[model samples]
Target: MTNPLFYAKILLFGEYGIIEDSQGLTLPYSFYKGALKFSSLDSEFEKKSNTHLTKYADYLLDLELPKGFELDVQKFQYEISEGLFFDSNIPQGYGVGSSGALVAAIFERYSITKYNPENISKDQLKNLKKVFGLMESYFHGRSSGIDPLICYMNLPILIENKESVDKVAIPESEEGKGAIFLIDSGMTGETGPMVQIFFEKMKTEGFRKTLKEEFIRYNNACIEAFLKKDMNPFFRNLKKLSNWAYEHFRPMIPESIFNVWKKGLDSNAYYLKLCGSGGGGYILGFTKDYEKAEKMLDGFHKEVIYRF
Candidate 1:
């Protein structure tokens, strides 16, 4: 059977903050995606993927499956034996939900009581998040499940803190000067350690206060502003959030991009923030003028994600 494509995701806001109940916004990036397929035993890639799928299936079976979710383990094992594999182009460890996409694809095809994307309910969404979260914990030590949820739905997810998650609509693209882009840090980041650093930092009262008063406030406001198409306030709050991240989330930002990150803020031409857990991988960038931002970041690799 042919399976549907699962796309990558960008957590535009709320990298570590979402762990502390801060709001987050995630969008599907169709540029890179994955799907499930069965291939002949001749392909080495297919053999390796089949092996990994077997291990992953074993892990999922060990979990306390959520209600309304069922996996046909026998069939899955048979398929893997037949060289079932995930054929994907999404880069792993780049904070773009690569593993999440894989998990979503597996569940979409294997889960018997599947949640209908067209008519998903609050209960179904919550249950699906729980299932995906548990399934993904095998990769990241812990997950909010927002990544796979976005991949599964292929829709923008607005996280209004830990309790409330809803599929949100973003404003239509504008042929304007402002834009959102991704800057490659040229290194893969491990989410576990990056998250560990944030957790350790949270033990400090000052860090906790800064996160609550500054980070969460600006992060949430940025989402609201962008949704309303309030460009001025969006960039204004984004700048503040970017500055706060530079000052507080320094460890999470890779050493190589520190200068470039600061340069953007100093120039007032653009702003940069952690794309996911930071450390290394893709750093998110915002610019009021893409042409100018490109000139400023000429040497580095940058991909425009959304145009304002």
Candidate 2:
């Protein structure tokens, strides 16, 4: 049987704000993807993945899943013994759902009660998020489960709140010069520590207030404007969101990309924001003029994911 492929994801908005029940928008990023495969474990990559899967299988065996949701852990263990490894090109720690894809692959293959992504309802989507949260927590210590859910459904999801999430339709890409892109930060980011920092920041009344009143407002507005194809409002809100991140998310921003983030705001050519937890990995960028933004961001690597 051919292994099913799982794609990477990008959380366009609502990074830390989601924990506080703010709205979020996430979409599949197909440029990088992964799949489950059996290998001889000869190559170092295969051997390492096999070892990790062994440990992950052990973890799954002890996990207490929600009622009616269970993994065939015995089969998973047997497959690990048979040199089952995740064959993926998604970059780990890039905030693009590498581990999430792996988790989705495991669930798709081993779940006792299968839920077809195409036929799932809103309630089922919520339950899937809860299950994915429990499963993906092994990697991040705490998880919102958005990453794995996106990978599993392979669809754009809009989070209305903690208990309300549904599939969403986005504007189709166009041949225009504007674009949504990713910029390589040239370093890997650890989600756990960055999340820790965000939690610590939450302790401050001022920061929490700003996040709710400013950050989330801009985030949700951007999502709404983008969906309606209101470019003016979208870019306006995006600029605000990008500026807010620069001012408040300083700790999460990697030092190397600090200047580049500021350069965008200053030049008005493009706006940049966190692709995930920041501190490294890929930084998301939006530009009304991709060519100008490309020229401004000359030294850094960039890939346009959506054009308008």
Candidate 3:
């Protein structure tokens, strides 16, 4: 049987800053998605996927599974062993939330009991995120689990702060030249090292202060404006957020795209930010005029995520 698919997620705001309790806004990308499905007792990719899933199920079973967050580890392991495979089109390490989708799908389909997002309290969401974080840590050494929760719920998730979260709805895309897009970095990035570097930088008071006061402020504004359907304010805040990341989180941006990333900001043709961990993967871009950004970023292939 095929489980429901979870769309890939993009952390529109709160990339690294979110780790410091910065406000975050994340939504699902329907263009790319993944789901757990049973395969015939064959196919290398299927077999490999099943084996990997089994290992994960075992890990979860070993963990002191937290309260409120529930999943049928035994049955999930059995089903996965009985030919289950995660069949997905979402690209891994492209910062599009590959592991997130899998975690979402698994939690959704096999959870012995489910927590309803509607009647559920905010604390429940946080707890779920914590549990999912522990479960997803199998894939990435560390995880916020926000991506998986958003993907799993297929809703716009807003992180009010470290302790509060809920499903939200952002303004729908408009018919216009303004757009949100992704640019391939042409290399894969691992979350572990990027997170390690982020933690290392967190040791500095200057960095932490800037992140809390400046970066998070702009990031939160961007989320609020976008949710309110105020494109003008959204772009205004996006520009500031992009600039903040460029200045403080330089290492996250790859060496190759460093100039282009900066040029976009300087020229005002577009503003680019880390789609995920940055170092390498997909770089997110925002521009009121897609033509201008396209002209500036000639060689790199780009996909429009949303239009405004």
For candidate 3, report its TM-score.
0.94
lDDT for residue 123 in candidate 1, whole number 0-100:
67
> What's each prediction's TM-score?
0.97, 0.99, 0.94
Ranked candidates (TM-score, high to low): 2, 1, 3
Q: After best superposition, candidate 2 residue 121: deviation in angstroms?
A: 0.6
Q: Kindly report which residue stretches of model 3 are placed more than 4 angstroms away from their true locations once superposed.
A: 116-120
Scanning candidate 1 in windows of ten residues, the lowest lDDT window is 66-75
lDDT of 1 by residue, 138-254 (tens): 999898888999999999988887867888999987788888999988898999999999999999999999999999999999999999988899989999999999999999898
What tens-digit string does per-residue lDDT give for candidate 3 at 116-224?
6557667778888887788789988888888888887788899887777887878778779899999988888888889999999989999888888898889988888
Which pairs clash inside model 2?
A: none
Instruction: Tell me the tens digit of each residue's lDDT in model 2 across 1-308.
Output: 48999999999988998999889999999999999999899999999999999999989999999876799999999988988999999999999999999999999999999888999999999999999999999999999889999999999999999888999999999999899999999999999999999999999999999999999999999999998999999999999999999999998898878998899999889999999999899999999999999998898999999999
Whole-structure CA lDDT of model 1:
0.89
lDDT of each: 0.89, 0.94, 0.84
Worst 10 residues of 2 by lDDT: 61-70
Clashes of each: 1, 0, 0
RMSD of each: 1.1, 0.7, 1.7
Off by over 4 Å in 2: none
* Best of the two (1, 2) by TM-score: 2
Q: Which candidate leads the pack in TM-score?
A: 2
